[model samples]
Target chain A: MSAATTMVGRSIRLSRRNLDTAIMAVVLPVLMMALFVYVFGGAISSVQSYVDYVVPGIVVLCTGYGATSTAMPVADDMKKGVVDRFRSMPISGFSVLTGHVVASVARNALATFAVVLVALLMGFRPTASVGAWALAMGLLLVYVLALSWLAAGFGVIARSVESASLLGFFMLFLPYLSSAFVPVATMPPWLRAVSEHQPITPVIETVRALLTDQPVTSGRPALAWSGGLLVVAFTWATWLFRRISSR
Target chain B: MIVETEGLTKRYGTRTVLNGLDLEVAEGSVLALLGPNGAGKTTTIRVLSTLTRPDGGSARVCGFDVVRQAADVRGVISLTGQYAAVDEEQTGRENLVMIARLHRRTRPAARARASELLERFGLVDAADRRVRTYSGGMRRRLDLAMSLVARPRLLFLDEPTTGLDPVSRTTTWDAIGDLVRDGVTIFLTTQYLEEADRLADRIVVLHNGGVVADGTADALKNSVGGTRLDLTFASREEALRARSAVGGLADGPTLGLPSDGSAAHLHRVLDDLLAARIHVLRVATHRPTLDDVFTTLTAVAA
Candidate 1:
């Protein structure tokens, strides 16, 4: 609908103007990748090449950062009283959330591209065919979409911007406990169970396998987790938005 | 009636905000909901604007129910909240155009409406500037202008001029006056008695989430006892003597009696005091204001 398009345009403009956050979303992940490749790569001998093994993890981390950034703007809108203005109009709550979610996906695309570019400069290489690369990016897109909606839900529940930024903390920290940095089997039994059972580890493993020409053992589970999260998160976010905005 | 509400109520937890209130507003009239803090003025506006639902009773705007036909109510109304709701990062023009577009205006049409409003509100110079750099008054004006982008039949303004400087307040008043000339039905809430006195054709004094007084400004003022003469004597004994001689309510050293505000009435009172050999220290006439009505009503309700 036209209302959704207008809201999307407005949200993108807001994202563009927020230069500090935009820069942080892109630059932080690239710096993290560099740190992992140069400083931590020598100590980890489980992978044939740490750079090749870690790039997929870094990609997922970058999207997590970008997607969680959606919460700040959503919280800002609610605090600013603009959401009341929109709700009083003929505009539906779906259009407003669509705007933020779409903008989050766009921001993730840019951040993901930047992380991949930096990985190549640091001696990282992917052995994937064109179809495999497309599939990997598609899965990353789905994962970002899911996380962004979940962040938007947090935004609606947050009473202030500071509380909303807590989503970023969780997103940034969850990947570290997953298989993104080290193999799940190398961890203690309890830690290994957590890393293998959580959603992020499977997504990172699937992307890593696809890019490295390895056996794709986690593909089905990755799709299942991402798809299930996308459904629950999208439903929760839109429902919360309507409830909060209306009364 | 363009808007009608009967026994409308809302409660947050155990504290009721709107308590079985009833109201009606004819088309093209300015109605001011006058009340102090915690009087539920904002809650009432929120319900009428379709942003909130009442707990017990029903409300209709433009012949559509506020709860069941909320989308239809939204089509005919706009709300400007106590806080300025403009986007700080977007330019003023962009803010206006975005709202216009949300109302289904074409891009060119939205732009034209935005420009026209910017010119009307004297925001042409800063139209393209980001709202972050705008002064408080400029932002308020832009907020009001955005609500007018769709030209709704009814507008709800909750404390529209609450925090503006004097000049900005007057400018906003002028803008609102212009809207009235265009036959727009306005329902505004204000803690400023002067604002309601200056703008409202019908003033409704709300207390404890219900209407305590509703009438024209002059009518409510009159209800709180009209002009009266205050006679202050040198001592409490002289005031008591004057009260017994002239028959007025005595409090300490002063005696207050209802008057028709005539020179002859003052002369007669002075002569009556003189005949009784009571010396009057000061003579002053007090006229009732909307403040008096508000205080009297709320105090009684409390």
Candidate 2:
């Protein structure tokens, strides 16, 4: 294989290196969707398909939570002195980090598919055509890319595994507090204002609008916020990565 | 010379680990760096291997500047440490093949190189087993084998046998000896002075971030002082008398006299002992060991 292909292959291999951990990573979102949509579905919504409201949100949650596995393993790699070995090797520096982030996103995508399949079986339907669904997929992926970078920064900055894992857990909480579950309109006035403007709400609303074909009142705002947040996250992550690496 | 470090200085905040260290390792030869703990051995390795850049000064490996031409330096050298780096999750064969593949070896060539390294390191049988299952020695061997996958001309070994038992140490020594015999110039950092004595054509003693002394093993031992001839008599009186006659130091039943461990010194000592009629029950010569060289060199620096 070519050099770039081999590097990509190594990244893929490293990402799939752990099976149990990957499964554990996805389990939280799967279980959260199942419990909230089935158990708490009756109390919260007037919408016919509770599964539809929850899966996309839960997938976003999965992307954020699954980020921990990526962070901790990289932290573990540094802690175990595995990175010292890599530093001496002829391998590219960015390849391992790229491999790590890409592999994690791949696993997150799989979990998203699983959550989507379960939602579909429970009557979750996207009113968007194949192309729109593709575009929505593109949007979720961009979201995952943003989150992957944030976790990458966490992996670099964290001095311990627990601290690294906390970065992802901390990010997951933002989605729950945003307009992911109940609408921002139902929240207390102060939280409602923050939730409406928060980054997660826009991405979630965009995916929701794409899936349900509702009149997206905040459509222009959602596009700007989602795309802007991705750029900001990427910029911060790269800056963080460079700082940690230099040290 | 393939590798040269000119005044490589590394400081971590307030303390300097490597202080303006200058050294040169010739091509197709070995230069063993000997020092105690925290003597900046690993720091030097990190700088030369392109792991961590030095705070000051420069190092060239494989004749390429470690900073500006780091890619060229990286292209020609490999480093292994006290711990074997074979991924415990991957099999021994897989680890070697993975490294080989990383060097852009084709599938068949990678497999072939992995097998060859396994055979050379006496790890062919356990090649399929995950490295976690291997013994400490087995794992270290596999790590060394993986390093040789590219047949790097310059190899950096940092305390490569620190935790190994005697048998394992000997096994690693033999492997290193084989590599040296193959004309691979090895730049090794070791705590074992004896290891340096055995393997290094020239040994440089590092202490407090700089060279304390650098010479061949025997040359270093010679620089410390002449050998001492210690003789023990049954009584303090005889020891005293022998001490006066030979101009030796008498403490208890022992007499310590300097000798060059040559026939002329022995003959002169024997004549004096006979002249004094001192009945010496036991006689022994204390040649300066590598330990003596280490202690003296580091002690003076300290």
In model 1, where do residues sit more than 4 Å from their true spots? B228-283
Candidate 1: pairs in clash: none
lDDT of each: 0.91, 0.79
TM-score of candidate 1 chain B vs. the reference: 0.84
Candidate 2 positional error at B173, Å: 1.4
lDDT of 1 by residue, B1-302 (tens): 99999999999989999999999999999999999899999999999988887888999999999999999999999999999999999999999999999999999999999999999999999999999999988999999999999999999999999889999999999999999999999999999999999999999999989999999999998887777788999999999989889876778998877667888889999999899999999999989667667766887799
lDDT of 1 by residue, A133-246 (tens): 999999999999999999999888899988998989888889989989888888999999999999998899999999999999999999999989999999999999878876
Query: Model 2, B102-172: lDDT tens per residue?
Result: 88898999999999999999998999987779998898898888889999899999888988889989999
| Complex DockQ per candidate | 0.72, 0.31
Best by TM-score: 1
Share of true Cα-Cα contacts across chains kept by each model: 0.93, 0.40
